[model samples]
Target: MSPTRSTRALRAVDAPQSTLSAAAGELIDADPLFVRERTAASELPDPAPLVSNLARSVVEVISGVRDIEQLSRWVTDDVYRHLLIRTQHAARARQARRRPTRRPNFVELSVRIQATTENIVDAVVVLDFGARVRAVTVRLEGLDRRWRASAIHVL
Candidate 1:
């Protein structure tokens, strides 16, 4: 065959390869893994329930009704440790003052979710313990499809 005809034949063979490569690239671009990743990343639990549960857990801890294990289930590791230390100190202070630490009588509780990202939320919670009202700011993180309180600040 002439060089011209040989070059044409070579191009004909490579034409299908290039077409196939393009189709394969499209398929990869539309892969299910990408879809799944996007869906998972965007899927976030409603912050209302999470904030309510966290607020209740904090109240339970402050009332001395919930133990460390129970608190751990609702809060992150750092919050758990912080709660333990604070509760211990409160207990010691109560003992020194010879005052009985009464369980808080929760009259009302309200939770307001301030901000939310893909995997994090900031919530403001107000709890009415009959004679006193406590406001708590909670930072929550989504991990393994569950919301856990990463930090809590009471005001």
Candidate 2:
């Protein structure tokens, strides 16, 4: 109840290390950049918070055939249903060609997705390969409790 008692209670809890301080110790950089909410969420989350993070992981996961299954795990249910799998099959297969080398190589892609929700959502994503962002698509889905992307059309 007292100020001193409250201060002591707060001090007893372990505090998170500031990312910048941790980075400073590791000698990583001066420019501070970080995506925080790997966990915390409130009643209202951002309209499109996961874009940068998901983009980063999507490349790593899809880099190998073995990891392809992981894609379904991150995405919400019905994403696969709406995704243009049959349509993109040909292009994806073509891109899957392993070059003549000691190991198979998956094509590197930078995927950008824009998502917004009202009663429903419209998501537009562009996958940028070095040559170009070879693919762009718009998907529509009902705004369930969590973000879900369904039905797609290439643009």
Maximum-TM-score candidate = 1
lDDT score for residue 73 of model 1: 74
Candidate 1 lDDT over 85-123, as tens digits, reads 887887788788898867667754677776556677788
Q: For every model shown, what is its TM-score relative to the native structure?
A: 0.66, 0.37
How well is each residue in 1-155 modelled by candidate 2, as lDDT tens digits?
55697786575454456854575556644434421122212333553544433443444433332343554644644554434254255346656784321222234243444434343444444555545553334343333344433443443
Candidate 2's C-alpha runs over 4 A off are: 1-44, 51-66, 73-78, 81-117, 138-144, 152-155
Query: How well does candidate 1 match the true structure, expressed as C-alpha RMSD?
Result: 17.5
Task: Itemize residue pairs with steric clashes in candidate 1.
Answer: none
Quality of model 2 by C-alpha lDDT? 0.42
Clash totals for all models, in order?
A: 0, 0
